[model samples]
Target: MPSGYLDLAELEQRADYVKTFEGVHIPGLLQTEDQIRAIFAASVPKLSEGELEVRVRFRLRRQEILGGVPYEAVIHEAALRIRAADSKVARGQVLQILERSEHPQVTVRVVPFAVDGFAGIGDPLTYAGGPVPQLDTVLMDTPHGGAFLDAEAQLARYREVFSKVEEAALEVIESRQFIERVVRSA
Candidate 1:
């Protein structure tokens, strides 16, 4: 869980743009209600039914940012094929990416499995903008929890990581087509 001052909510309020990369799971801000519920249902320890509902509600609420923020998500093809729930939910997840990719504020790109020399194997990351370059922050997910990095050296490394990962991703139109194929075969 995130703290109050530096949580995703507060960070989003301060940033104008956010770029993310997801490997094994869908990024939170881009997830739909049904997909989020499915993710929560698969919690490792197994969240209680009530806990699952609460997390799902919180996740769905965060997705509202997609309508206004200039957000870009580069997702791995493996994440798309990994089923979080039944076929219905997996199909919905594929279509969700396709539908949201069409939004003016949201850009969804894919890092196909065939890409060579891919570098983003660590974890999901959100690189957020700040009023000045010096104030930028990088948020990386971990099994323990979320880790925030702001030192100049750390920021620079993540910046390079994001750039290389983004470059390996398909272009907007190609990404949409790739996801559309997944949807059709789902």
Candidate 2:
């Protein structure tokens, strides 16, 4: 498969070979149906009702990696707390994360809000597999669209930042508990 907008699709096809890092909100690969609908509705408000459903289904299709693949995510506490579209939607999102984290192929960690001056403080990113074992790319989310970075230097920097962010984040079990607490509060 060609790379670009279909990067997520490619990742799903080659699920065993992908590793991802998400700084804001849960990664699409881990989002629930309700959470995905809310995100698409807000992000693409111009879509007609029918188009919205199509897009949400497409987004949910990306979650196949959670079933049988090696994937990991490092999410920030602030991102988890922000209501994607509304409090109800956000609550459901947290529950989804809690459920998905139990899978053997998935690892979800939370970077606490108290972490001082983290590398991924301002932006959320996606890292995808490349053609080679040591090759990979970084995709940064933008207001206009996603920007893909394939240069080795840029990918290296982002990888280092992700490593640091993970170091500053809660352990997998702790992160799950935090998400459960948030869901219960909602």
Candidate 3:
């Protein structure tokens, strides 16, 4: 959800729980300003400096939900290891993830390289709950752009996909430890 999307505001306000997955990039809500700037700078067509600032601000603003909502972020080890900017930025990100994991509302897990049967490589998703289970929406990332899936079958399949990936992830405590080791090597 970006700054001016009324729909994003409304949905987030009414949601009971939010779940996210990141395989390549950091999940949008958990990304920091420096990381966001680095990503925008690396974009193919390249966003104007003004647009980049706007996006970074929007992303940081959306992060406030980490304290308000029950959010679960399942990230992969590969995403954790890649230094989008540099070691300082990566270390800050890992520390941020560790700090936020202490919040009662946020749950962060990492799927390490040793994990098996985890084939959700191309899927990046945020499953936002609604007033009722039937109203939930699955937001997915594709090569082209973002996609929203709301049909029953689609929802069921995505739910299963998320479940399996989450199953392969390290426990919260272990995940933090795994990230700490990464920082040590960095």
Q: Distance from true position, residue 160, model 2, in Å?
A: 0.7
Task: Give per-model TM-scores.
Answer: 0.93, 0.86, 0.92
Q: TM-score of model 1 relative to the true fold? A: 0.93
Can you write out model 2's per-residue Cα lDDT over 10-78, one digit (the tens) per residue? 655763455565666778887878877777777544677887787787777777656766777888777
lDDT of each: 0.84, 0.74, 0.82
List the lowest-lDDT window of 10 residues for candidate 2: 1-10
The runs of at least 3 residues in candidate 2 whose Cα sits more than 4 Å from the true structure, single-residue gaps closed, are 1-4, 130-134
Q: Candidate 1: which stretches are off by over 4 Å?
A: 1-6
- lDDT (10s digit) by residue, model 3, range 1-186: 343344554556667899988888888777878888898789778888887887778768878877788999999888888889999998888777788888999999999989888764557888888667778988887777667788989888888888888889999999988988987877
Please list the Cα RMSD from the true structure of every candidate, rounded to 1 decimal place. Answer: 1.8, 2.7, 2.0
Say which candidate scores most in TM-score: 1
Task: Give me the candidate number with maximum lDDT.
Answer: 1
